[model samples]
Structures are given as C-alpha cells and as structure tokens.
Target: MASDQSTNPPIMEAKTRHPLHQIADTPTHKLLLKQWLKEEELILSRVSHKESQIDSVRREITQLYIFFFLFHSISLLLLFHASSSSSPSSASASSACKRSWIPSLCALLSSLGIIWAVRYKSEVESHLEKLLEREKEDAKLLRKCVEELKKKGIEFDLLKEVDALRRAKSLRVESKPVRKWSARDFVTLFFFSVSCLVLAMIRLILCD
Candidate 1:
C-alpha cells in the first residue's frame, strides 16, 4: 500500500507537468502563436486605417451638403431679386431699363446663372450621397471582418481575409463626370436673352 501511494504521487506529478513540458518543448506552437499575433496586429492596423478613411469621407460629405444648401439659398435670393427688378410697373424702373441695356441684361444673366447653379447643386448632391453610401458599406464590411477574426478558435486564414478586403477596396466606384453645357443649355440661354431684349423694348415703347 505504501509503494502504491508513492507511485501514485509521481504519476500525478507527471500528469500535471506533461502539458507544460509539451508546450515548452515544441517550437511549432511558439512559431504559430507568433505568426498569429503578427497577423492580429496587422489586421487591427488595417481596421484602424479604414476607420480613419471613413471619418474623412463623412466629413467631406457633410461639407458638400453644406455647400449645396448655401448654393440653393443663393440661387433663391438671386431669383427673387431678378423677379423684383424686372417688373415693368414703376416709371423709374422702366426709365432705368431704357437708359441702358445694362440693367435688363444683368437681370437676364442673373436668372440664367441661378438656373445653372441650381442644376449643378442638384447633380453634386446626388453624387456626394452615392459616395457616402459606398463609404458606409465599406465601413460595415470592415467591422464585420474584425468581429469574425476576434472569435475564439476561428480558423479563417487571416492573410486570405486581408487579401479579400484589399480586393474589395480596389473595386471603388468611379466618380461621375461633371455635366457640360449641351445644346439644350445653349437654346435656353438664347431664349432667355431674346425674351429679356423684347421685354426691354416693350417697356421703352410704353414709357415713350
């Protein structure tokens, strides 16, 4: 019974030390752990970088929206001012319109400028909104990938995941080209100019 008790102690000690010995003795486990730590660091860095990019994109979108609002306000004010000045009622206004073609021509140009500005603002707003949506989607995908990597015993290859993320990042949407003046624009401008000239002539004739 004494010998059995002594032998049992050694066996229990060996059993307790076995796992530690195995871990210390193996180079492969240490190497794998080092590699895994490196990968984790790299992934964390990438996620941080993506987060910064998303923040920058968000700021840009906000600026664009502000600018759009400003432009819209300016266009409305210009339109209101043009409408008020172009009225043929007041004798002074008619005399001003007749004295030189300048005031009437200025009103016509201002109206046309407002129309062009409004159209440009609308196009720019739409483009910025689309860009914001894409940035949000990218941020979501990156967060999801990070969560998956943090899971216990997850066997996903980190390199492959990072490569996939890079590929996705590369597939960016191209910006739409800015609209150029078309035949429609020319025609509209021509009509506006002619109408202003005719109105000025009519006012002058009435005043005389």
Candidate 2:
C-alpha cells in the first residue's frame, strides 16, 4: 500500500500548478509593464517636440520685436536732432514742418507696432511657458515610471535622464569665455561713435 501510494500522482496538484507555472517565467504582468513603457515613451516624445517648437517660435518673435524697437529708436533720435536745429531764419518753415510731422507720424506708427508686437510676443511666451510646464510634468511621470519598473524587478531604458545630463554638460562646455577688449575693438567703436556724431552735426547744420 505504501509503495502504491508513492507511485501515484496527485491529480489536484497538477491542475493547481499548471496556470501558475505557465505565467511565472514570462508573466502577463511584465507585458503590461512593457505596454506602459511604450505609452510613456509616446507621451514624452510628443511633449518634447512641442516644447522645442515653442522655444523656436518664442526666439524668433523676440528677435523681431527687438529689431523693431531698435529701428524705431534710431529713427526717433535722428528726427529729434533735425527738429531741434531747424529755425525759420535758417530753413523753409514748410520743410521744417514736414520733417517734424514725418517724425511724429513715425513715432505714432512705431508705438502702435510695438504695442502689437508686445501683445503677440506675450501670447506666444505664455503658450511656451505652458508647454514648458507640461514637459516638466511629463518628465516627472517618466521618472515615476522608471521607479515603478525598478520595483517590479524589471529593466527599462533610463535614457531620458542621461540625455538631460548630457545636455546640461554640453551647455556648460559651450559657454563662451569672455575675452579682454582688444585695441582694435576700441578703435572700431571710437570710429563708429565719431561717425554718428559727425552725421548728427551735419543734419543739424543743414536743417538749420
């Protein structure tokens, strides 16, 4: 009886173990984890690309606005000198009036242009800020996913953090070193200033 019992297979044991054994080596849980990783990757990619685009647009808008401001500023200054030295005895009143009115018109137009540009730039900046925040949130989520995968005894790419670190390092490396101003640079600036002064004097005398 003892020998027969030892030789017999327990029927319930095989049934109970089959399902668990099938899943233990290659679990459905891991597949779910992999799927989650893919989703996270997709989200991260979308957000990052959106952030890059926003940054590019913001840069362009800022450059254009700055250009507009500088151009108008110079025009206003030149007009001021022309208006200052013009006198009834020295120049025709009609021409002086025209010159004065032209500068004023330019001033008004430039003011309006600046206002519009600033409003547009502000809107774009706000959108870019929101995108930056969204990217930050996505980064946090990616970090959490990596941690959870670690807890699950799973391995996944942690390339994002590595890439971020590399970017920071590259930025540090690419920073320009400030050099002492050379004599040539000083001479160039001096000549430019003198030229501007000469032009201003000429305009003043001719307008007068």
Candidate 3:
C-alpha cells in the first residue's frame, strides 16, 4: 500500500461553464439581447399598469368610507341631542318611548355601512396581493431570459440595471392609503360600534 501512494494532488473537477467557447460580438446575439431587454421592459410596464388600476379602486373606496363616517357621526349626534332635549318634559315620556325606534334604526343602518366598508377593504387587500404575485411571476420569466442571453456570451448592463430598478421598486410600498385608512377606520369603527350597541340598549330600556 505504501508503494502505491502518489505525490501528485488529486484532480479537481472543472465546472462546465456556458459561453463555453468565447463568443464573438456578432450582430445576431446582440439582437437577441435587445429582444430580451424589450421583454423586460414589457414586464415592468404590465406591473405598473395593473398597480395603477388597483390604486384607483382603493381611492374610490376610501372616499366613500369617509363620506359615510361623517354622515353617520353627524346624524347620530343630532338624534342624541333631540332625545335629551325632550326627556325633561314630563307629559311626553310615552311619546319619547314611542319614537325610540328612530335613533336605534339609524344606528343599525350606520353599523351595516361600516361592515360593508370593512369587507371592501379586505377585498382591496386581496387584489393587491394577487397583483404582486403576478408581478413576481413576470419577473421570474424575465430573469430566465436574461440568464440565457448571458450564457450565450451576449452581455449587457441593461438587465442588471433593470433588476436593480425592480428591486428598488419592490422595496417601496404603494399602500399608504390602505394602511392609513385601516389604522384610522378600525379605531373609528370600534368606538362607533360600541356607541351604537350602548344606544340601542338605552332605547330598549326607555321603551320597556
């Protein structure tokens, strides 16, 4: 066994790299690279267009939510004030009990609107997630095309720049409106929901 040992180092396996033969800067491959670059541009454009449509939908929902929140708050305040004003007049106690349904009914309607807004917000979030998933798939395809071109020895900095742009854009969020609405609206809805429950209970007590 000692006699069979060799002094030479073990042979290392070489990684088989593509562009195996140094490719010449031919017009055909440069055209191919250009085609891939064009495809990348198309991918970016599609994502931007879809995101804009989602943003439009989110804005419309926010506007409608604000409108209803203000309307209900105002109407609720007016009803409470009217109820309090007439409570001191002794002869009208039965009448006040009879009209207890008015504010209770208004509160019920406002609660329904709030529930609808919450449902719509959840829908917008789902749509945004779907858009992001589609964007990721498109980016994956573009990466494959770029890598293939690179393997053919047709190299350009354009794909690198495009990837950098895509990553940078991904780091940003277009969800400011969604986040702002959720934070503020959820708090408002919680308070309004409690107030509505309490008011309904009070109205029941008066009627009974």
Against the reference, the lDDT scores of all candidates come to: 0.56, 0.56, 0.64
Q: Model 2 TM-score?
A: 0.49
Candidate 2 lDDT by residue in tens digits, 76-119: 56666655655656446556654644445545555555555655
Error of 3 at 55 (Å): 3.8
lDDT of 1 by residue, 107-126 (tens): 45655664565445445545
Q: Total backbone clashes of model 3?
A: 0
TM-score of decoy 3: 0.55
lDDT-best of 1 and 3: 3
Clash count (model 2, backbone only): 0
Global Cα lDDT for candidate 3: 0.64
lDDT of 1: 0.56
How far residue 161's Cα lies from its native spot in candidate 1, in Å, is 0.9
Reference-based TM-score of each model: 0.40, 0.49, 0.55
Residue-level lDDT for 68 in candidate 1: 43
Q: Who wins the TM-score comparison? A: 3
| Model 2: pairs clashing at backbone N, Cα or C within 3 Å | none
Please provide, for model 3 over 101-203, each residue's C-alpha lDDT reduced to its tens digit, 9 standing for 90 to 100.
7767766776676667756765776677687676767677667756765775634454675576567657756443534455546756774766576577647
Worst 10 residues of 1 by lDDT: 147-156
For all predictions, the C-alpha RMSD in Å is 10.6, 11.4, 11.9
Alpha carbon lDDT at 155, candidate 1: 44
